[model samples]
Every structure is written in structure tokens, then in C-alpha cells.
Target: MTNDDLQFTDDRPITTQAQDLLDRAGFAQRLALAVSSWKNQESLVISLTGGWGSGKTSIKNMTLDHLAAVQGCQVIEFNPWQWAGQDSLSSAFFAEISRVIQREDPSDDDRKLAKLLRSYSRRLNTGASLADGTAKLLPILLASTLATSLLGTLAQGAVAQITWLGVAGASALGSLSLILQRSGAWLGRWAGNLDEDAKDSALTLSQLREKLQKLLSTRDKPLLVVLDDLDRLSAEQMKGIFQLVKAHMDFANVVFLLLFQRETVEQGLWKAGFDGADYLEKIIQVPFSVPAIASSQLENLLFKRLDEILAQEPQLQQRFEQDYWSRVFQRGMRPFFSNLRHVYRYSSTLAFHCRLLRGTEVAEVNAVDLFALECLRIFAPETYTELSKHKALLTGSDPYSRQDEPQRVRTTQLMDQLVSLAPVPHQAATRQLLQEMFPTLDWVFNNTNYDQGIQLRWLVNSRVCCDEVFDRYFEMSIPEQDVPNSLLHELGRRITEPEPFTILLTSQAEDRQAEILQRLIGLVEEFPLDQSVEVVRTLLHAGERVGRKISFTNWSPRQQVTRLLRIYLQRFEQEADRSQSVINAFALTPGLVVVEQLLGADHALRRKGDVGYFDDSGLEQLKSVYMRKLREKADSDPDAFLADGDQASYLYDLNSYSEGGDEGRRWVEANVTSPDRFLQFAQGQVSVRTTHCGGTTTRTSYIPVSSLESFLGLERWTQWAARLDSLELAEDQCRTLALVKEALAQSEQSVTAEESNR
Candidate 1:
């Protein structure tokens, strides 16, 4: 393969590689057209615009290559930024062009150019030359004469003084003109003879123009001068180069492909006195924009390239799975793989890791894995810092809305982290964590109205986190006094969680276990309402298995039940209203049974002279009565009992009533057979009541059963029963049942086996 076909493996210069690719890619036709347009004296400037990685430089190099090889075009490519000082930019440009001409064509023309350059060099080196210095200064003499005449014309009887002043001015001008003219002439004469170093130093605006004009006049074929790396140049130097091309070389038969970033070029031109568009029009005869390859196409390109590498190194082929390649391409290439440069960097890093694993048990590289690894290496530090920064930004807000804060902060932090982590070497554990966290963060940020701007500010501040360990630690570590208990609480919460959890665990298994229970408890407390009981149960189980004592000190079983029941009721009511198939299934299950059971008891107790007692045969009738009372209560005043204190007190009273004895357990068991039944019972109990005759009197009733069963599932119910059985016989079981009822009322889903069994 030619150099052009070979992607860069390192940071070496790519001039040769770029040119080869240009030839192979069949870009010669367009290149020649560009050259011809210049030779025809159509336009002096052309812009080679491309997206981040579209081979703009390669095209420029191709034009330069063609000029150097087949076209006999003398091309001088100068990147102004490479030169430190811009004091003599014009001279330096001329010098570079002269060198290129000689380098490309070293014959009779070269000889002529060489002789002229020698004279120029000599003149530049020395103060005087073979020509009489006084005679050579004729332009100054003419200027002085003109000045004297002008002065004499303006004033009478001041001839001598005016003459003297004019003479002085003319002499100064003459000397300046002589120096400039000689410099131009010498540059023209030796335009092709200068070495790279000399060319670099001798480039000047005038000299560059002279060389271009001379090359156009003398060269047989079309000439192309590719001014590349203009983006690297300082604002002033770029402006100067552009001005020289526009003002002096406009009519020359030389095509100048000025390579630069669009933004940089526009900005530079704007900073100069010229109107960007107008100035561009004057110089750029043709403009072409290079767009990024479509994501699908780019992925194909990566696969094709990887296939070639795999073919060459068969052993390396086995390391990666087919899906791995796709994953890596999707993950890394989607966001920032805009150019060949990015492709090269990504591939090279993969190759580097592949090489490291060669000749060992380590097989072919998993592209996705490698990509993630590389991302971590490149981005983890930055991500970590950004997270900290965003956290800080969030901390700065006063009376922050708890609902809005963490999501916003975490999303911003994750985005910044993902961007940073993208270019690192792979570490499986870290990569997995990042993948899970980043996408979650992305979803939150996009779907919700998080403070994106503050997040960005925090991200900018996070640059410091990318430093080495010492720097990162120094920058992110919090002070002892200022550290909030909530922060520790959050971290602990993460440690105990499983998949979809954000806790980062250390490699030491024992260590992970040691603090896990505490973390789990903290997380349960921190996110009790947001997290499912199943999650809390799993955490508790995991902690217990590792010999940790699980505590629900802040976890109110009644409150949890109440929350679950409410959620279930809302869902069931909505489904029932819609008359969905799910509702039919729900009606047949424990939901209808539970609702009927509670409502029956409530009605019997309320009935005049009717004892609230029922035999086995009257169970159905009793349940219907309870259900009716619940419906009545609900229809009475829905909002009155929803108040915080009222609900809490009601839940507490229900807990007490349920602890009355075997009656409570029997009541809960009858009601909570499924999620739906638990919800109905809980909703019935919590619904407020008012007098039927429209009187303003209100009564708060504590329904005996809690809906915890729905929230904790069957397993938790068994566990709570076992625990209660261990405590006080029937009373604890009753209380446990009541709590379960309350939990089921408030939750959206069932809890885990461990919580139920506990």
C-alpha cells in the first residue's frame, strides 16, 4: 500500500502520505482544475474548507505533490505559525518560494534563479553592493526633488530651507526605495536558489509576490502554491499573508490553496480591516466545503480498516468479537470521529493495546472494550473532575430544590465525564460503570429541565480533575468541616446498589462487603420514596449475607406501605376507568378480595344494631360492606385526608389497630392477595369521610390494614410475619400485616423476597 493508504500510526508529518492518497483517490482531476484556474489568471485564492477531519491538508498536499512531480509547478507551502516572529513575514515567504522552485527544478531556470538569489543574499548580508550606492538611491533623490518643488511652490523666499527639508525627505525615501527594489530584484533573481532555512527567513510580502509573478512567467506548466497550516498562524501573520496575496498576487497565474479552519480564517479576516465575505470573494475564486462522513459510513470505514489489520495479523483477529467492533465504533466514533485524524488516533490506540497483548494468552482486541478502555484513559480524569465541579456548582445554590438538583448536577457531570473518558485505555470495570452512568445521565438531562448552563460551567471548572493523581486528589478532596453528611450518605447508598446503581465499588471483595450494609441502609433512607422496596430489600439481603446488620431506623414500614398503596390505586383506577384487560385480571385477583374484605367490616361496624362479626359463610357479605364504606369514604372528601400530618397519623393509627390481634392478620391476609387488592384496601382505608347529609363534619378513620404487602411482595410478607412471630405472638403479626397494607398502598411495584421474608 502507498503511504496515502496507510493511516498515520503516530504524530509524524503526513505530507507524503497525504499526496499519495490524493493520487489514488482520483483527486488529481479537481487538483489540476484548481491549478489551471490559477494558470489562467482567474483567481489568486481558493479555500479548502472541510469539517474537522475531512482530508483538507491531504488535498492541499496532493496539489503540492502534483506541482512538484508531474506538473513542474514550483510550490512553496508555508505554515506561518511555525515561524516564531512575524517581523519579516514577507521576506520569509519569498525565501520559501525560492527554495521550492530550486528544489523542484534545478536546470537552466534554476541556475538563473540561483544567480539572482546569490546577489540578493550578498546585498542583504552586506551594507553596500557592486552598484554605486549613491546612484542606486535614485528613487530617494526623485522623492527629494518632488518634495523640494512642492515646498517651493507653497512658500516664497524659503527655497533653501524648503530645499534642504525636501532633500532630506527625498534622500530618506530614495534609500528606502533602493533597499526595497534591490531586495525585490535579488529575490526575483535567486527566487529558486534559496535553501529551506534561507527561504524561511527571507519570505516577505514583496518578495513572495515577486516570486509568484516570476514563477508564473517562467514556468511551462501551471503553478500551485499551497499555503497550508494557516490555522496555526497568529492573527497578525495570517492577515499579512492574506493581504499580500490579495493586493499583489491577484493577477498572477498562480493558484493559492489557503488551508485553514473556517472559523479561524473568518475571525482573522474580520480582525483585519477587510469585510470577511468581500475579502474572501476577492481572493477565493472557488470554495468547497468538506463535510464529515455519515456515521454509518464512518463505522463501515472503521470496520474495513480493522479488517485489513486483522488480515495482516491473523492472531490479532481472534481477540475481538464481531459485536465488539460494532460497539466500539458506535461508542467512540459517533460523538467525535469527524476526521481521519480521529480515526488514526482511535485505531492506533487500539493497535497499541493489541500489540501489548500479543504472543500471550490475551487474544484479539475487543474493539468496544478497547475503545472504552481508551476512553477511560483519555476521559476518566476529566469526567471525575467535572462531576466534582458540577457538585460544587449545585452546592452553591441557595434553598435548592432537591428534586431538581441531583439530576441536573449528575447529568452535567456525566456528560463532561463521558467526553473525557472517551479517549482512554480500557479498563473493563470502569468502562462498564461509565457506560451505564453516561447513558442514564444523558436520558435525565435530555428529558428533564436541568440547569445545563451551570453544568457546563462546572465542566469547565473540572479541567483540573484531569491532572495526575496528586493533582486530582488535591483538587477534589473536600475539607473535613465542610463535608456534608448527605454526601457520605449518597456515596454509601451507591456502594450497596446493584445494576443501574451508580455506586463504584473497589476491587477488594472483603472491603466492598464491610461497608456495603451501611451504604445500603443509607441509600434506603436517602432514596426510600424514589427507590423500589425490591431494591432496598436486595441491598439489605446483600448486606446481611456479608455479615452486616441491616437497620430500617429511618424507614417507616407504615409510610412505605401507604406510598405503595397510593401508587397501585392510581394505576388500578386508571386501568379500571379505561376498562383495560389488565383491570379484569386485577378484579379476579386478591385486589377485589382485599377491597371487599375491608369495606365489609367497615359497613357492618357502622350499621345500626348490627354487630361487626361475621361467620365463614358471611365473609363475602362482610367484604362487600367494607368495600362500600371505602367507596363512600372516597366519594366524600378525597383531598381532606391527603394532608401530610393527617395521612401520617392515620397510617400510625392503622398500624396500631392492625396490631389488635389475629383479626388483623386475618383481615390483611384476606385483602392483600395481589397488587391490585392491596391497593384497593389501602386506598379505601386512606380515603377521607364526611357526613352523607352534606354537613361540614369530618371524621378521620384508621383502616386496620396497611398495604405493605403490595410493596414488599409475598416474600417480604413472610419475612415480616416470621419477624413478628419472633417478637410477640398475634399482636406483632397484626402490626406487621397492617404495615404491609400501608406499604402496598403507597408503592408502584412489589418488593423483593428478602424484605417479605425478613
Candidate 2:
């Protein structure tokens, strides 16, 4: 069973009394001691700074227990992320502050302080919302109403007096009306109220500060309000939290501990248009960075978990025997396991692959190498893709030379380019780990071999880095389709037999052949001797059917892949079948027809002792051995072997011999004796001469041959005539008659010349 089915945790922080990080560097004790010794009413802002996943929350818990138990202080935990999308962090924080400070059966002063602070918090929110406009405008509106009331009373009195003295009061009435109008205009200008607004703004702030002082005076224990996850909030909420803690929330007996990644918090501060560094410095009086987990501590913890996980997987256990291989994995893995969470992330992900690989065709790929690949998948995926797509660079030589040399000098250089192109910022240590893990990629100390190349091919072929892979360990909201585990198990079971393998492979379409070939190749090493033979046989059959495409240095992958499989397979193959081994090698990837033809010609020639039989060299290697026999006979006495070599057309077939196309034909041409026999050899083949259609293309058609060119004579013409006469009357003999006539004319010319000589 694969470790994938086993229960595994994916990098979640430990909340219970988990001794995962066992006080490395005595960090917990030191931090707890520091917070415990703080003086009362100092009102310090201590920043617990660490990168994400570096045990910040654990440290916070340790410090909290220390403060409450030893230091005798009241601790309040404030999570700003809870108010994520809102704009009320100031109100929410003070509410938390009020809840903690207000005792269960509060004394009168305690109740008064809580009430005062609560009221102040509300007014502070209101004044901020209104911009103190209503506070300033209130007194102005009251005074304006009183003045209007006074004016009406005076106007009524004047009108009564004016009615008593009719004509005389008419002149007085005009001046009074003008005075009232001017007075009304003066009151409206006072209603602009700019000056009153400033005074009221100062008063509101002063009143809140007074209430804050009263609240602090009532508290016996110093208030330790711990603010966490400020970095997790949206911009508006983050701004509110920062402003609340930095400016509004400060008080005499309250110490605020802000816990977040400095970089993330600074980014939030940047969005809020505050000078992040300066703002943090002003608010945070004491900055305590989380002690980094040392390499030794990481190794101890990582190995403990790895041992636990790998205990069940015997396949992975095999890797530890090779000292250098084990060291390579450990050294490469060190950079990734910086903390407990990172270790969990890597181990849990690897476990899934380990489970998925068990009893599968690809299980032959070393399990430790698979783990290293998992690390790369998490940290440097683009590099992973490069390794996957271009395995040829690892297997063969001089492939990347033509592909822009300046850019592709060394593997590390290519890696640096790839890492730089990634959107996420990966550490330089990750690049180092990648290079160390894949040592056979290319270097002087890192000389890559065929074995390493084969291992790389497995990594690329596994297709192990995808969303479905991620869902195994990581928590995702959306469910993904599981990998075809049932299908995989069936393939693993069936690949051992030749019939099922052949039938299943051949039935798969051409596109699916490559994937099947990759799976079968991975299984080559893991299989028993008999099964290995079956794989070799099946793959060879496929090759013969598929033929060659995308040529390697000498042959295509059809033969190249077969070459690797058979080379490894032969170790387990029986020596008694060594002769048959060569034949099977030649015949199956579906066996090479070229080798069968060569073997046939060799067998024919050997009966008369003209050539010795070829030994058990593989198809490509044996071609050289086979070629020597043919060349020996041809050089020593070409005429003797020609009768059979001619019958076995492969001897003269250009593809069978190296650089023998023109040379072999020329040898045959030079050694011919009788004109009629040579003419028979040269007959019926079209030699084309064409005009150019383009740079590389040419016009092609058939051209007729002449009698002298074919070396036809009187004997050749007589033979053709006899054969034609023997044929059916309706048979096509026009071309045969034409050649005979030409030969007959040539024979007459020759005879006439000979008679003149007599």
C-alpha cells in the first residue's frame, strides 16, 4: 500500500500540547522571561516578527502562559482578521480591551472605568466619522435660533409701537426694517462656523484622552493585548488596526504585542500610505525576531518524521544503504526544512507519491529520488518542467549547443534563468538544493551517466506535479479527480506477462504508445528475469510496428529505448539463449527486418564456407560484425558471392551497409563479365534526371534506357524473343520487343565490324 492512503497532516500549526519543536535555542524560555520582566505602566509595543511558517504562533502561546502564570498579568488575544472586510477595527479592539479589563464582580471604580472607556470608544468613532462638524455646528445652531427668537420679539414690539403712532412711525419703520435685514445677514456669516469646528475637534480628542487615563488608573494588572494576523486583513481593515494600535489604543497600563511577518505587515502599511519602517519604529518600542530554527535542529526533526514515514516503505528503505546516495538526499533536502511546517509540507507531499508509486510500473524509480523531485515540485516547478521536457540533455551529448549557447551554458545557469522567471520569489538555497539533488544533470564533479539519465526520464515521465497531486496533502476547497489508481494497479499486475503487455500496448493508439513505453521502461529494472524478457519482447514488437521516428544519435527511440531496456534486461537473461537473444533483439521492437535479411544472407553464404556466421552482438552492434563478413568476400573475390548476394537483395540494399550506397553499386558495376549477364543485372530500373522546381525540390519523371547503356547483345535479344513468344498473346510485350530489336541491331553492327577485320 502507498503512503498516500495513510493519514497525514499538511503543514497546519500545532495547537495542542505538541512537542514538535522541542525548545530549540531555548527560544521559548528566553522570550517568556523577556515579556515577564517588563515594568508596569510602561505601555510598550513589542513586535513578534518572523517569516510565515516559522513558529510565531507557538512562541506567542508560550509567552502568554509565561506572562499569566509567572508575571501575574491579564492577557487579551486580539485577532484583526476576524474583522477582515470591515472598517471598525478601532471600535472592535477597544471592545476587546474593555471586556478583558472589566472584572466579573467589578468594584465601582472598575465599572466606571469600563463604562468611561466604552463611551469614549463610541464617541471617538463618531467624531472621526463626522469630522467633528456636528460637534462644532451644534453651538452655532443653538445661538442662531436664540438670536432669531430675540429679533422676532423686538420686531413685534416695534410693530405695536409703530401702529400707535401711524404717519410718524412710517419713517422709523423703514430704518428698523433695514437694521433687521443687516442683522440677519450678520448671523448667517457666523453660521459658516470654521473657527468653532477647530475648537470642538480639540475638545473631543482631549475628552477621550481624559477617559483613557481614568481607565488605566483603575487597572491593577498591566494590560497585555496581543494583536495577531494583522497581516491577514484587507487594506482598509489593516489600516484601521495599525492606526488604532499606533495612535488611539495607547494607554498608561496597556502593553500591545503585534505579531505578524514584518514584510507582510509593511506591505499593508505601504498600501495605507504610511511610511512603513518609520511607522513601525514609532509604534513598536521592542522588536523581537523569532529565533531561526538551526540546521541541526531541523535535521533532527526532519529525520525523525522521515524515519517514521519511510519505515512502512521498504522500497525507500533500500536507498539508505548507499552512503553517497543518502548523503546526496540529506544535503539537498536541508535547505527546504527550515522549520517544522516546512518539514511537514515536504514529507506529507512525498508520502502521497510514495503511496501512489507502490506496486506500479514506475515503482522501480528510486523512492528517495522521488522525494527530491517532490521538493523541487514545491520550490522550483519551472526547473522541474525543464528536467521533464528535455531529458535528452541528460542522456545524450551536444543537444543544447544549437539552442542559443549564450543562454544555455551550464545547468545551473539555465536553472538560475528559470528560477528568476518564476513569479514567486524562491530563496537562493532552493537553487543550490536543486543542483545538488540532480547531480547527474551536468558538471565536472557532477558527471552525468546513462543511469542518472534513466532516473531523470522517470521523474519527467511520472507527471507527478499537478493539481490532483496537490490535493493529496494540501487542503483545497475544490475537489479534484483522483488519479487512475485502479487502472495503475491493473497495469502493474499485467505488465509482467508478454501477451497482455503486447495486446494492451498494440491496441493503444499511436499517441498513447509513448506513455505506455515510458511506463514499461521504468518497470524494466524492477521485473524478474522472465518478466524483463517479456518487456524486451513486447517493446521490440512495438518498435518493429512503429518503425523509427525522431532519430537519436544512431537510431530512433524505437531502437534506442529498446537498446537501453535490452542492455539492462540482458543481465537477467539466460546465457543459453544468448544467440536467440540477438535474434529477439533484431526482430522485436516488432524485430528489425534489416537484421533478419542480414542473418538470411549470412546463413546462405555460410553453407559453402564463404562467410562465417555472425555472433550474438545486438542489432546495431552486430551490423558491424556482419558487415566485415560481406566486405571480406567482396574484396577477396566479388564474383563468387554475387550470385547469392544478388539473390539476397539486402547485401546490395544501400541502407544495410554504412556509406555503401554508391560504393557497393560501383563495386558490382566494375566486376561484371558477360555483356548479356550485366545487361540482365542493369535492366528495368529507372534512373531519373530532373529540372529544379525550387531550392530543394526537383521535377521527377521516368527516362528510357538505350541498348549500349544496358550492355544488351545478340544473345540477350534472342533470350527476350524466346520468352516473349512463350508468353500469352495478350500479355504486355511491346517494351520487351523494343529492347530485343535494339539489341539485334547492335549485334549486326558488331558482326559487320568483325567481318571487315577478317
Candidate 3:
């Protein structure tokens, strides 16, 4: 997919006329009917409640849209939160209502009604708005009058912020009586303007109600003023809005719709010293809460856009199975995101990172890995961090790696806890998917009783699951140089054409060549048996072209070919023909190195004890074939037989010789000439001396010097002691050498005494 497809977009509210998604729940129709039924009500308030992201705003928009289309219906949308921070909720609500009324109902009489509404708001500000600056000025005009009036009660209880710097609060209060005298006649004039009867009056709650009725006389059919986002206001603002609405309603032909989240509104009511239920029931004629989004609807919405992104990846469709789609990817990816915005977050990230990977990185990665990892990265950043930091442990790269004891029992416990960051039902499924994408530290699956094919498929299309790839996916720098698609595809084409494949890789150094081969071998494992064998043949061919500068050092050329075969053999062990073919592949080599390498395959090195991977009979057959090859080489060239018979003969019960009597004598004489070489073989460590000898060089096990002494007879033992004495040795080495030295001296002395007696 292109980068533009992956860019995250702004989450604009779905327009009310944009095909009414709320119709899925039939909320649109139900809410429309409820609003239509309230046509003749004198005054009423309705509340719509739901949690954040539960589509409260959407529902309000839908209701407004429905009402706006009806005959002679005027819908006025008032957002209190837009003005909540700018001034008092009482003044803000009245001002917004004045604006909407003036805009929607602008006839000559409606204009007069708008002017009267503005004047009524000023009266409310004078008596009730504890925070308005206009209210602050009223105390000067009505100080003594307010002492016994409702405005006086509010003035005593409310403390307006009047700084003493300029308008000193004390000085203002001190001249209150004089100011009242001057403003009395002026207040008298303003009172005449406010009252239709032209009587001087104190603006009380009863007076405010009378003023609202005068404003509503010009009201059109069922004026619905929607007050939404009330929950977005502060506690004080919320209280002020509710109080203002309660006082102003009761005028005919006016209806108020108040929208809020239940808990937030309840908390505001409780803080205001009113029982939430009691207070709500008193004002609201009808209360409606939206039902939750259904699982089917949520899934449809979530994956709708994602299907387009996946359409770009046609190869992924063929590589993954139905189980991976339904059982792993779908099951694991769906639970973490339930909302539209969350779905966008996960899908966008997955697309961007997948777009970044190219060449072998893409070819080696699994689709599910990218999908699930991006999901974790968005919804669970901490868990994603764990995956990046502990890739080897999570992916089974280091099989023996684990925390000690109690921790070992729950191998993925930390991951499990991290996995718990997702919902509970998802934990097991997510764990299974991660294990599939990344190899587990322990080959054991986190969840059993589930179908798991080879994990190789998980790495087939991408290495996004690899730690290095995971890190680079987030880097802001330019992409690093990596093996290109041209090279990887060329190598793939020569799967069985070893000559050109080997020639193609000849430029790489031995160590680098082996490393690349290991990667290729792993990548090949993801394919079917025939495809895997084809890739294996090409990888084996690469050994012939590798530089011998460090050839056969760690992964010897012969071992490189055979190591992959051993992996293949274990996987297809039931297919006996494939097993024989692997044996035949080992047999095709022209040199004796293959024999030595194959013979030591079953032995335990420095790592663990012998693992029962290959069949015992198979290993024996491999060993017998290798031994016969060695005998044939010895028969061709006597000096070519450097293998000592004692080590094998101890177990094999054979002599210290090759197959032919002449070669066996020569093999004995060769060891006899340099007994230290024989001594070195017995130690099972690296031999210090350099010589042209073909043998198994990797010593993963160490044997004792005493075992060597017991295994060797008089001629070999005498030669061994002479060399140990002549050679320079460390204190520890001298101690072991001295043991043999003492035995040789005692044998010589006994022989001398026998000669003297004769």
C-alpha cells in the first residue's frame, strides 16, 4: 500500500446527514418520534445520557437533523460548553439562546421577542448570576432593596472577585447608600423599560418567570433548543446551566434537550446538595440512554477500511491459511479496539510499518506479526516495549533462556501480564498469535490444544517480528542498507542450481556467508517440503563458493549443508525417502570432512546433553556410512588415516588402527611419533599442535587425562610421558603430566631390577 493510505486522519464528527449510522440501533427513528410527540407541550426538558465515545454527540446531531426537516419546526442548537469558560453558565446559556432565536426566528415580532429575551437575561443576571459583572453593578442600585429580596440573598451568599487595587471592595460597599440614591431614579427609568405595566419592581424568581412568558408569546411551533455537552462543563457551570433551565422553562411552545454523561451529571447534582435521581426526575419528562454498539456492527465498521489495505497484499492471502485469518489474526486483533478511532489507530500503524519493510525483510516476515504488533503498539505501548526488548525470549530464539525457578514455570508470565493489558478473553488468543509470529523462547506453545503449523510461515513475508526490524520500524532516519530483492529472488530462482548460487554468494566472506545462509535456511523453512528442499539445495551449493579463510570454523561448509538437512530430517522424519535423500546429500561430498562432521552430529558438545532429535538407528547408519568412507580413504592413501582407534575402540572395541592392517600400523606409528597429539585427543579440548590431520575439530565435551592413560597400552603410554616431560607446561598441566611421569619412572625401575636379578 502507498504511504498516503497509512497516514492517520483527523476524527471529525460524522455529519448528521451522512447516512445516519445510528439507524443500525434504530436510535434515530426512536429519538425522532419522541421529539415529534412533544409538539404541544408548554415547556419540557429531555436528557440523553451515555459515556464518552458512546455516540452522544452523534445522537444529538441525528435528532437535530430529524427535527430540522419537519414542517414548521425550528431547531436551535445551543452548546453551553462553548461559553462555559467565557462567563457564567446562566448568562452564556441565555446569550446563546438569544443568538439562535434571533437567527432562526427573525420576523418583526420574533425580533421584538429576541430583544425582550435579552432584557430578561439582564434581569436574571441582576438577581441570579452570582458571577456576572453586570450583577456586581446591581448591588449599588438595590443595596437596601436586595437585603429583603431574593437578589439580596444571592448577594450575601456570593463573593464576586472585586480587586481592591482600583475599585476597592470596601470603598465600593461604603458608598453603596449614596450610589443607590443617585441610581434610584435611573433604576426607576430602567424598571419602567423592563416591565410592560411600567411599575417599579424587584426582579425575583416569580418576576423572572413572568418575563419568560412575555418572551414566549411570539415563540413559533415547538421551539426545541438543544443544550448538548453539558458534561463538558465544570461542576459550577453544570449547576448553573441546570438551575437556569429549571427557572426559565414553563413558557408555552418551548422545549429544552439537555445532553450529558450519566456519572458526570450525577456528580454535579450531588455536589450541588440535590439527590441526582430526585433532581433529574423533577426536570426531565423523558430520559434516554443509548445502548452499546453491537459486536457485529463494531467488527463491520472496524474491518471495512482494513480490507482495502489488505487488498494491496495479494501474496499474503495465499501464504496464510483460513485458521490464521479466523482463529489467530481476527480473534487476536479485534478485541483490542472497539471504537472507530481506535480501529483507525491500529490499522494506520500496521499499514505504515508494513509499507516500510522491503526485500528480504518483507519476504521473511509474517502478516499476522505486523497486524498484531501494531495493535499492541497502539493499545498497549508497554507490552509492545516488552516484545521489542525481549524478542529472543518471546520468539524462542534462545530456547534455554528463562528467569530462574518460579518464573520459569510461567515462561510467558511477564508477557501474560502484559498480554492482560488487553481484555481477558483476548489474552489467550493474543498469546497464541504472538507465539506464532515470534518463535517462543521455549518451543512449547503458550496455549495447547490449538492447531499450529510450522512457525516458519509466520516469518515468511516479513521480519517485523524481529527485534532489529521492530526498532528500525520506529526510527526517523533514512533506511539502512540491506540485502535487496534482486539478490534474494535471484538466489530463490537458483534453489537447486548450486553452481550459480554458490557463484552468486562467492563475494561474501566465510562468516558473513554462513550467516546469510543461516538466514536463507530459516526463510526456506516457511515453504512446503518441495520448496524447502529446493532452497536447501541452493544453500548447500553456496558452501562450495564461500571463502576458506575461515571456512569450517563455526559452521563448517559440510556442517552448514548437513545442519540444514538435520533440521529438514527432523521435520520430515516420517517421510523415510526424504531421510534417505538427506543421507545421500551428505554422501555426495568428495572429501572426508563430511564423514567427520556427520559422525559427530549426535554427540553432545558444550551445550546440553545429547538431544534425541534424530532417530538412533538413523544416526548409527550415518556413523557406519561415515566409518566405511574413512576406511575407503585410508585404503586409498595410508598416510590419510590420522584418526586414532583408541577413542572409538574404547567404545567400538576396535584396535588403534584403520581398516587395512598396513594403514592401522601407520596410524599407530603416527600417534606413537607424537604422543602429545594422542594426549590432546583424549583431553577433548583444542589441540595446541598444528598438523595436517582430518578429524572432528569441535570439542563440545572434555574427557579426563586419567581416561586416556587407562585407554592407552605400554607403547602409547611410554611415548605420551616422554612428550609430556619434554613439553613446557603450566602448573596445572605439570601436575597432570607429573602423574604420567611418575608412572613411567616406576615402570622403568621395575624393569631394571628384573634385569639386575637375571
Q: Tens digits of per-residue lDDT for model 1 on 601-703?
A: 4345646655333333344443344344433443455343332223333333333333352333343454355433433444444433445456556655443
Give the candidates in order of TM-score, highest first: 3, 2, 1
Better of 1 and 3 by lDDT: 3
Best by TM-score: 3
Badly placed stretches (over 4 Å) of model 2 are 1-13, 19-45, 65-73, 79-92, 100-110, 126-221, 229-253, 260-287, 299-333, 336-416, 422-758
Error of 3 at 669 (Å): 15
- For model 2 the TM-score comes to 0.53
Better of 1 and 2 by TM-score: 2
lDDT value for model 2: 0.55
Q: Model 3: C-alpha RMSD to truth?
A: 10.6
- Candidate 3, residue 551: CA error in Å? 12
Give the per-residue lDDT of model 3 (tens digit) for 1-758: 35345455434545565655535325765676676666453677888888767777777777677666764356778888888665345655665667777786488767765665666655654444333334556666566444334433344322532222223444446567576666565466456445632243455646756766765754556677788888887777777778777876677677788889989888888887878778878888878886777777777766675676556554444344556557555656767666656665666666656555422323323455556667767766766666656655554445465445554555557667767766565576567656555543343443332223334333334445543334443441223444343355565566566578777776655555554455455545543566544544554455444543334335644456556555655566564454454456546553334334444555543136655444556656655665666566545643223342223332221232224424433444454355444544333222222334476454332233333334454567666767677778767566546555555566667779999999
lDDT: worst 10-residue window of model 3: 649-658
lDDT of 2 by residue, 459-484 (tens): 33332222222232222112223333
